[model samples]
Target: MLNVVALMGRLVADPELRHTPQGLSVTTFTIAVDRSYARPGEQRQADFIDIVCWRGTADFVCKYFQKGSMIAIDGSIQTRTYQDKNGNNRKAFEIVANNVHFAGAKNANGNTGGGYANAQPEYTREAPPAAAPSFAIGNNDDFSVIDDEGEDLPF
Candidate 1:
């Protein structure tokens, strides 16, 4: 049976990372996904989904992502039941995320303690410098010494 699910949405809050009793890493967060269609004269609606990640995935998520950061998750749906504080039974549904990927830019106010702006590249700490190759020939005339015989060409 197939139980795969995929979703792309913005994080509703920062991922909370913790350790299980066995010392395994775990993280939990919520994603806010907008509805595909909007009713006339009505605002678009969003669904808040709970997600859980384990091991290295959990560490990576908590370190890089923040609230309002767009992300894509691939996982399976899970449901569980427990007793609430008031002695009432409660049921919860969540996604057990196997993979998580950054999806889009964050809003201006979404920046948490991280100093970088949303427009900054998420993977790089600094912009790459632009420079001309040291071996580059300035003009086509520089290659005039080449021969068509497929023999060794001088640089």
Candidate 2:
């Protein structure tokens, strides 16, 4: 009975925001989700998924997220049917987002947009491990070598 879909991917283009007659906000965008598996010697494939958000989520996306921004979306699949130009019925599938999150690295300006309602600190990458302390004995005045004490020492 679960119809939830969760995906993390990069946006293919800026989200398009629209307003309904009643003044409800809506945004539609596509994201490129890379396939998990690829054949040897072949490039990995990506699926362009259509996503839809309503009201506040739509406004948040338009205010921050942009093309090529990585995002995590949690939603349910929805299919709607409409008539094409030739009067043929067409069905389109999309995710109706209940949650939107930012997942990309910070830019040079140090902004990761936002996750959910605002930027989630959990998305930030950890700093690289610090370099190990130097242990070599240099030719400094502080080092003194003793040979008669029978004390084993590491140089």
Candidate 3:
């Protein structure tokens, strides 16, 4: 009854944007997701996944995303069947993206250039100092963990 998926990967190529007869926008793209494990002496493998975005999401992707852009996707897996040109039935699988996020690295100018001119972060320094750690190493009265008697913590 529950269906959900999350992926972080780089775009295989620029998304193909198109309009339906009803004038609705749609965009299709592929992302290369690398596998976490590989056999010894073998290189890591990657799987190219197809993604579909509709309307506002499609427009945002076409305007901002480009080939090789790293992206995070939150959506659900969809499967459908169609006949290929060879007159054989085929099954297609893709993600129906509810949200697509920017995942590319920030460049030297502190910009994440995913085809769109990047925006600068609030802490705009050449290099920021390391942040201080919050937790105490030894016992500290202020940071005591209360046991919940094997019950989930109340929200």
Candidate 4:
């Protein structure tokens, strides 16, 4: 049997982080995933998915991520039953995130600023190119000669 799920979407709200009795960090947040299809005259729909992270992952998410930040989640779907304040048993479903990654551009502080700033790719210039590689075609006993094919070869 297998149970696995993956999602890439924007957060509907900022993650709420808390500590349990044993001082374990936990965080919960909702992701707004847009539907793949939409009707001719209707607006696109979004699915609100609940997600949970634990320990170091939770702490990292709480510290770096924020509402509207795009993220990728690798996890499994989980369902649990709990009683509400009115004593009604409720069944809840959520993703138990094993790994989370920032899927969008970062802010000046290297964190996803959510809606605090316009989303833009941060660019940095590359260093000067290095010298060309030296090729050795064969062993000493059976040597072979090779020449540069120029830059026209297909990758």
Best by lDDT: 2
lDDT of each: 0.85, 0.88, 0.87, 0.86
What clash pairs does model 3 have? none
Q: Per-residue error at 21 for model 2, in Å?
A: 0.3
User: Candidate 3's residue-wise lDDT over 82-107, tens digit each?
Assistant: 99999999999999999988888876
Q: Which ten residues in a row have the lowest lDDT in candidate 3?
A: 113-122
Candidates sorted on lDDT, descending: 2, 3, 4, 1
**Superposed Cα RMSD, model 2:** 9.0
Off by over 4 Å in 1: 105-155
lDDT-wise, the better of 2 and 3 is 2
- Candidate 4 displacement at residue 70 in angstroms: 0.6
Tens digits of per-residue lDDT, candidate 1, 24-74, equal: 999999999999999999999999999999999998888888887788899
User: Each prediction's TM-score against the native?
Assistant: 0.68, 0.73, 0.74, 0.70
Among all candidates shown, the one with the greatest TM-score: 3
lDDT of 2 by residue, 1-155 (tens): 99999999999998889999999999999999999999999999999999999999999888889888999999999999999999999999999999998788877666675433344455678999999987677747776876866656654
TM-score of 1: 0.68
Q: What lDDT score goes with residue 66 in model 1?
A: 84
Once all C-alphas are superposed, what RMSD does model 4 give against the true structure?
Answer: 11.0
